[model samples]
Structure formats: C-alpha cells, structure tokens
Target chain A: MCDSCGCDLASNNHSHDTDSRIIEVHQSLLAANDAMAARNKAHFEAMGAVAINMISSPGSGKTTLLEKTIERLKKKIRIGVIEGDIETDRDAQRIRAKGVPVIQLTTGGACHLDAAQVHKGIHLLEKEPGGARLDLLFIENVGNLVCPATFDLGEHQRVVLVSVPEGPDKPAKYPKAFISSQIFLITKTDLLPYFDFPVTEARREALHLNPRLQVMALSATSGEGFEAWISYLEGLTGKTRKDNFPPLLSQS
Target chain B: MHEMSLVQALLTQLTSLAAEHDKKKVITVTLTIGPLSGVVIDSFQFGFDILSAESNLTKGARLIITSPTVSYHCVRCGSIQTAAMRPDHCPECSETLLIAEGGDAIILNQVEME
Candidate 1:
C-alpha cells in the first residue's frame, strides 16, 4: 500500500476478493449545495428577479442596509427579502414595515443559510403580496463572518459589509467572506469621524483578498454614499429583466 | 456547527455508495480537505466518528483525511509556491500580493467497501 494515498491496487476494483470493491468517487462535499444554488439561481431568473446574499458579522448593518435599500429602490423596482436568523423574525418585521414582500427563515441554531433553506424561503416568499412580481431579492444571511462564507444561497451577487466600529482588520481576519463576496461594503460611514476605522486600509485589504471585489463605503443610517448601492441594484434589475427573464415559475 | 451537517451528508453518500455497489460495509474512506475549505479536521473527524458508529454501512469505516498544499500565486511575478501554511511573501519577488489557488476543496476521493 502506498503510504501517501493509501492505494494497493492501481486500477479500481481489481481484487480477487471481489466482495470488496474500491469505488472511485471524486466529488465535492459542497456539491449538493452548489447544485441546489444553481437551481435556485435559475428559479430567480424565472421570476425575473435578481438575488443578492448579504453576509457579515452581527451588527454590521445587514438589515439596516436592506431597510435603507428598500426605501430607495422599492419605488422604481419591486423588492422582496428572505431574512435568516437564529432566533427571531425582527429583521423581517422591519422590512415588512417598508411595504415589501418579506419572509423569515429562523435557522434555529444553524450558523448560515444553505441552499435548501433558501429554496423553501423562496417558495414562501412568493406567497406574500408583492413577492410574485419582485425585481430584486435580498437574502439577508445570519450575522456571522466565519461560517456563512462556505455556503452559497443561490445569489447572483454576494455583498459583505463591515461597519466603521468593526475596524479595518476584518478583511484580513476573515478572508473567506471577502474572497467569496462580489461586493465589499464599508457600512456605518457616518461614524467614521468618531472611530479609528481607516477606510482606505479596509478597502485595500479587501481588494487584496479579492481583486475583483467591488469595494464601496456607505452609511445606511445617515444615507451617505447610498446612491451607489441603489444604482448597483438598478443595474442588476435592468440586466436581469432584459436578457434572462424566463417563464415565471409562479408559486402555486 | 456546520460540521455536523457535513458529516450527515457524508454518511448519506457513503450509505448510497454501499447500496449502489452491492456492498454491505464500508471499510475505509479517503477525503482530501483543502486549507481554505473552512472545515476543522478535528471537528470533522469527531463528527465522523460519532455519526459513522450509528450507521451500518460506515460503522467501522476508517477515515483518512489528507490536506493538499496551499499554493500562493504572486500577483507581481505570477510565481506559484505550495506550502503547508500561507507563505508570508512571494519567494521570487518578495511581494505581498499573492493569489491563492486550489486550496478550498473538500472532496471524497476514494472508498473501500465490502
């Protein structure tokens, strides 16, 4: 037997004792999630909607950003949200007040939102009043930096946000979130003057992790630098609505 | 943690593999865990040990996990170097801009069943 890979027979299943067979199966552990995510992306396309997954540590302003974004884009484009949390529906309630379709998935104890949960969430979302006609879908993932990055929830774009108080080391400390995300948002820019957060260092480190990550700074509370986010959403809605709108997989 | 879920998925796969090949038992399982897979080897092994004992197919299956080398590609010179841990700087050009490649996989490579 080779000590490195632990293989006695070169070919698979050549043993004289055919009762024991070596099956050569090379597959990723995340394959199931990836496959489901791909299907969910197609489902989003069928709804003529663009989905973006929001990832960040707790209190990094994910829900706040969603609330502010809904306020800005809901007038021009229909918006829906799927909120993931460990215990409460508080975030969904916040979005509900903004007069948009919102569904909450309480993960109980799960750290991140997986594709299977999002599949069910998407179904439940369509039952809401304006869910069927959504132009944008936001999946507000659980607030944890480490675990959520491993799972893909069928989003066209993934945005990772870090608040001003969170400091500039987040991108270096939590590289997975920055690496997997398409957009790196520095939230709570309103507090920048009071805190020691260096925006340039934050942006530079995030860019170091992923050169393609579109880094932006914004304050959801103060509404500073919010237009860029709104425009990004509009751009997604425009492109998705025009080129890839499939037959509406209307939820029955 | 998600390790429990991953172990559940792995057990399910092993059960199906045993059934597909007309094998009653899984003797060994080999997995290649990459550095960036965000999985703790100890936790995964612990999860596997506990969960595999509950199942008939993988009750006594030995789990062998190997971590592949992490390659850091220098953004300056495009030179790739493999190391157990992330290299501090590019050896060729002493640059900090290094792009990682192929260390995020968690793959089930091979299985021995009977």
Candidate 2:
C-alpha cells in the first residue's frame, strides 16, 4: 500500500515511483493582485497623494458627484481622476473638462477593474500635465457592485454609493460591497421626495454590515448636505477652504 | 462572469504547479471558497468545467471545493458566533450590530498530480 496517499499498490517502493503524489500547498488566489495593490499603495504615498476608489451601480451619480466635488475643491486642492468603464472615454472626458488631469481605463468587457489596470492608469496619469502632483486621486471603478468589491485597487479609502432612485435595499442585497467599504454615500438626495428610498433604513442596513462605515447623504445638483462631503475630503487631504476668508483678511 | 476569470487564474496556477513537480497531469485540486468571498459556487464550477477541459494538464481533473463559515462579533455583548450564513442577531445578546470577520478568502489548498 502507498503510505502517502493510501493507494493500493503492490510495490512498497512506490515512493521513488514519482508517478503520483499529493502536494500540500495553501495560498490565496488573490495573492498576486494583493501584492500589486500593496505596491500601488506605496506608489500613491510616494507621490504624496491619497487615492479613493468609488464603487456603485450604473447611474448612481458617481461621476456627477465627482464633477461637483472637483468644481468645489479643485481650486483649494490638486485633484486627479482615473475613470474605469466598459467602453468609451466619456467619463474621462467629463473629468478632463473640469481642468484636471484624468485617465480613462476601458476594461473592454471586464466587470471590474483589477489592481493591474489601476497601476497602468497611474502611470499614464503621471504623464499628464498636472498629474505628477496631486493631493487627491480618485479611481472611479467600473459601475459594478459585485465583482469590484473583490478587487483591491490600493485606494486609501473605499466608498460605496447608492442613489435615491436605486432604493434602500442595495446595502442589504450587496452585502460584500458594504462590508468592504469605509464610507457609504447616499447620493441624489434631491430625488428623495419622489422616490420610495428611505435614507435611515439604508444607513442602518449599511451600518449593520460595517459598523465603521461613515454614512452621508448628499445631492450634487441641489448642493444639499454637500458640506459634510466637502469636509470629509478636506479632512483626508488636510486642506481647508481658502475662499472662506477674503484675500485682504487672510493670513499670509 | 468574473468566475471565468478566476478559473483562468486557477488554470494558470495549476499549470505552473504541474511543471514545478515534473508532473504531466493533475488528478485533483482542492480549494476553499469562503461564503463571503462574493463568488458564486455554481458559476465557479461551471467555469472550471469549461476551462479545465481546454488544458491538457488539468483536463478531467476533479475539483473539490469547501466553504468555510464566517465569524460575526457582537458589538453590544462582545460575544462571537460562527455560521455559514450571516446571523441576523447575536446569539447571546440579541444585538443587531454584528461585524463579520474572515470567510472572505479563496484559497487553493492542495493538489494531486501524476
């Protein structure tokens, strides 16, 4: 009998046979991606920038929120964006029109943007006019809630968004997205009056999944509850509103 | 499906392992897919069944998958409970806030090659 695998063999010298053997190996399938993500994190830190990955479903207002955020903070802080999409550079174009460095990564068909894709985006972005220096870098993930949650893009913060029209059951249905995120944004608050979405229920469901998640509701259109969002970004970048005080009264 | 991509990754790993061991064929591959890994078990199986047939080394290889339970820690009572599915509340304190830990890994455990 073969002692290694308990296989019935007439020859006791099967050890040297080398025809069959059981190899004990334990490793995560995502090890390669994780190693790349670690390198990307180091790269982001070396560039003196903080990276944030945004995950949400289609039409959840990720780009609109980013546009508003850039319009609000671009003057105070240097901002860059890496947009991921299945096709078309439309998102990248929109970000570029805001007078900031931006790169678009089209997965071609992949549902999620992996670390390798973001690594390429970072290199291309650095070559842009203002991309070399940035206070904040936002990687807008391919509009997906499921597969995107499994890939780590080396972002300092992971934010998941759900618009009012998407209903309040998103957090409950997409537990993985909520579980892995640091912040949960309820976007499109202006539509709350028209939709059946309940903000409190969504917040509670997300909090139940991840207690450490910082929940906020905002509308990029009406600017409702936008202060908190701005403050959060300012807090991360260690920048404050410079326009708050008049230039004559500002401290040199 | 993303499962197809994962299956390709597995096949690549298996090919390298076979080459390292000087083995020509893989007999069995054992893996652990956690419940919270966000991978559909059936989709993964379907992907493996299709992709493995395209490779000589992994063709007709048996895939054994084991799903492990996740541990949910209660915020109120500090009690911990382990279950394959997410518990609605803490077993001891009935606390609704339970933080899940672990059970999000997809690991290749072992392989039998010939």
Best by lDDT: 2
Q: Candidate 1, after superposition: displacement of residue A78 in Å?
A: 1.2
Residues A1-252 of candidate 1 have per-residue lDDT tens digits of: 544445785655345665887889999888889999999999999988999999999999998788777766666688999999999899999999989999999999999999999999999999999797778999999999888898988899999999999999999898888888999999999999899998999998887767779988998776678767876888888832243322122110
**What lDDT tens digits, residue by residue, belong to model 2 across residues A164-244?**
999999998999999999999999999988999989999999998899899999988888888889889999999876656
Question: What is residue A221's positional error in candidate 1, in angstroms?
Answer: 1.3
RMSD of 1: 6.5
Q: After superposition, how far is residue A99 of candidate 2 from its true place, in Å?
A: 0.7
Question: Highest DockQ among the candidates is held by which one?
Answer: 2
Interface RMSD of the candidates, in order: 1.4, 0.9
Model 2: number of backbone collisions: 0
- My TM-score estimates for the predictions, one after another, are 0.88, 0.93
Give the top-scoring candidate (TM-score).
Answer: 2
How close is each model in CA RMSD to the real structure?
6.5, 4.0
Alpha-carbon runs more than 4 Å astray in model 1: A1-18, A239-252
Model 2, runs deviating above 4 Å: A1-17, A243-252
